[model samples]
Target: MIRLAIAISVVIAVPAWADIAEPSGFRGEPYTAPVPSTLQGAKVIDAEMALTLWAEDAGFVDVYPRTLKPQGLPEGTIWQEPRHDTIPGAIWLWNTGYESLTAEEMQRLEDGLASMTRGNPDMPLVIFCRADCWMSWNAAKRAVDLGYRKVMWFPGGIDEWQDALGPDLVRAEPVAP
Candidate 1:
């Protein structure tokens, strides 16, 4: 009787410890075609696809984290192309990735994007960051929310870019250093 009672208690206690939450809300959803999987309504693509699109004159954009409070970025923490050569016409938009951004900041980013694109909404814009980074995800979402329909997210980011394109393709060093 005691043994059964102890077993029951152990089983009851085990559930509390066993409840482990997933990180970054990663759902492991299978990749589907036609519409590109997204983090938050933003179209996401792989590095290979982005490269192909860029080669075809599709406008690509990089949404990166900012070290500075606003506008300016800290030294050594800016986004760069794998070959130090961006996708010809790619633009860099620094969005610090703070938990919350002010309305003014959002407007600034929108205005910058508008100016960069020359008011062309049809221009293709690709957003990227290191793999598994939620920063890019959030940035992409914000872009979509702002009515930028041509935005694309590069999920593989720098790591996959280097692995597939070789060392010569990697121009930007890791920021953690």
Candidate 2:
């Protein structure tokens, strides 16, 4: 009886100790964690390869989320919006990389992608965020799902680009949807 009771207790406790299952869809929070080496439909590239693509005028999309002003600050608190710096010509598609997307967010992503590709699904599109961040992975995966013919994922992102190419970046704002 004691053994059976212990087994029951353990079975109940196991769930609490179990790790969260990786979603078959989009990845959720803790977006800064390490990601898989490959994104099934996209070509995963390193800094050198990304540099080559950049030189060739491949469209780049930065998926780093913008920091919005915090709400509920004590009255008269100064809130400065944070500036974002990205690849010289990359379009910033803010907040589209999150796991959950509202209708507006989805439209923003689609519109930004269209603007980047200029209505040519066959155009080479490179997607990225910071190194080891899953936002880039999700964004790259989304590009593939959106039927982009040529999707290259720079998993190393802006940091790697700067490290390899002498720190060239430009301040960017999110493209209007």
Candidate 3:
């Protein structure tokens, strides 16, 4: 009888330890559907702008975070070409893979942004990773924190872009140089 009682207590205690919530609050922030003026405050660009930029070569800066990971790739490989095509003149900023980020990865992201911005305080930049992804959310927030006056967040990332443009877009090969 005592053994059974102890087992029940152990099971109850285990759940208490497992109930800890993630730090970002409710799986990070709430995400609204992409809109034109979504980046009004932080200079974020949504999927629509990314597509438009790809088609028209609009002069918006494209950036990605380290935490954003491609759907499938070998470990330690920072960037991958989208299975579908991407916007022209887009640049990859590998901070880390999807799932979680470490302090070192965040630092690398900050350094990358500094290099990309190149002291252009007024430079407008767009950052993305994947659709329905929290990495972009966290990355966008980081950009804002870094004092990027015009930062756009492409929530759809590559997924929505491929879906919208179909074959019209061009896919690039991942190069290691």
Candidate 4:
């Protein structure tokens, strides 16, 4: 649980760069066509397809940046509840500096992903987070480039899943480091 808390805190705290929950580090990727049409081997799927793959224990990655608190609240303002959820069994993948992962971080990401998929390179890995969010797009692309072979990107994100599976059906996991 300590690890989880640290992850949440990191996601919430904004760096010296961008404002709001919008990822400050990397914003280089395009938001349109959240899913790439020509990903070579990776497949872009919808919420429904994501569920289908989950039944087979496919890996699910949540690249959404978590928002813990709003900035500059009034002196007596009460904080509103924050909503940052992932699909069932989704792992919170952090978004760092323009998706330009370091060699160590890249290895760690690849290793975590492999562990999630039980070290099976051919296993399907489903990734999602927010609608039109480049974080997820870049992560999905990176996963494919890592030779995962069965990388899947769900473009609609948490909102998409909530819309399709009803709001309550969606699940949440603490953002990971």
Candidate 5:
């Protein structure tokens, strides 16, 4: 009788299974999906699969964190060289990132997505940068909101890509040696 009672309690304690609550990355922040349910269908992929399948044909956008260059150092600030770059074929668009974007930034994001669509909502768009980065999540969600039928979120972004495919695979963007 005690064994059965314990089994029943354990079953009751188990949370009901559900689709990934946050289809975007699992970061609770200014960038969590406003309507997480709507993100139910967003495809999430890794760098290897992305490179093998959609790398060549998808509208890849790099949502990597832009290195914020500090102006006028206070003194003795340890400033390390920013290692920022996009995947070989990913488009680098500034201000298309951030969970809380200004009106103009949002506009640019929408415009860029629309330009990629070119009236075809079914165009597969892959957005990524770093693993678990909120920037990519917000951007991909914005794409889906813009009626992009094929929105893919590469959670394992450039970091994973370089780890899997090597540094030679990425392209040095706006700033690099």
Candidate 6:
């Protein structure tokens, strides 16, 4: 009877589950979806707030995944990589937001953050991708994990930026570590 009672208590103590529950680690694929309202260690901001930060010269990072050219294609086939545009002065940190990353990939993110923040963990660094995208969420969480003191997550990413500002975004290339 005590065993059954303990089991019931455990079940009752469990929090209600939601489809968009924020996991302790990076979110998995189907990267576009609803995100949690808060990121524990970082500030979650909207487009207007992002603009304010931009005006303050905060470092912005675009974590939207880059499409890699397929391998084993016919030699005669032509391929063009997709172009990504971001907020002016925002650095593109391509492919660093995946749930799983190799050691080298993790190094890239660390190095990029270190460079952008000028080795100051307290610098205001904003990380983003697109509205409803978890890539930004993952990246922002990773930044917090890396000891960034002023990490801001612009969850409403480029979509919100374009709506709030204008179509004034510029093409960006990923920065080297």
**lDDT leader:** 6
Where is model 3 poorest over a 10-residue stretch in terms of lDDT?
Answer: 25-34
Give one digit per residue, the lDDT tens place, for model 4 in 1-177.
999999999999766444324332344755432333334456878878877887777888876655665788879988765655567777766542136776755665676687788888888888776776666767777787678888888877778877887335444654444
Error of 6 at 27 (Å): 0.6
TM-score of each: 0.57, 0.83, 0.52, 0.65, 0.66, 0.86
Candidate 6 lDDT trough over 10 residues, lowest sum: 12-21
lDDT string, candidate 5, 1-177, tens digits = 999999999987745343335644434365422223234457887767778645457787776556665899878888874766677766666557676677867776776666756768898888876765667777787777778888888877777887886335455463221
Give the clash count for model 6. Answer: 0
lDDT of residue 35 for candidate 5: 28
Q: Residues 1-177, candidate 6: write the lDDT tens digits.
A: 999999999987745333456797899888987888789899999988999999999999998888777999999998988899999988888888889887877888888888899999999999999998898899899999989999999988999999997449999887754
In candidate 4, which residue ranges exceed 4 Å CA deviation?
1-38, 66-83, 102-105, 166-171
Name the runs in model 1 displaced over 4 angstroms: 1-37, 69-89, 166-177
Full ranking by lDDT: 6, 2, 4, 5, 1, 3
- Determine the C-alpha RMSD for candidate 1 after optimal superposition of all C-alphas: 9.7
Mind giving the per-residue lDDT tens digits that candidate 3 earns over 33-75? 2223243345555566776554554332233332335577887
In model 2, the worst 10-residue window by lDDT is 14-23
lDDT of each: 0.56, 0.86, 0.53, 0.67, 0.67, 0.88
TM-score (C-alpha) between model 2 and the true structure: 0.83
TM-score, model 1 to reference: 0.57
What local lDDT score does residue 106 receive in model 3, on the 0 to 100 scale?
Answer: 59
Error of 2 at 128 (Å): 0.4
What TM-score would you give candidate 4 relative to the actual structure? Answer: 0.65
* Model 1 Cα shift for residue 30 (angstroms): 24
Give per-residue lDDT, candidate 3, residue 72.
77
Model 2 CA deviation exceeding 4 Å by range: 1-23
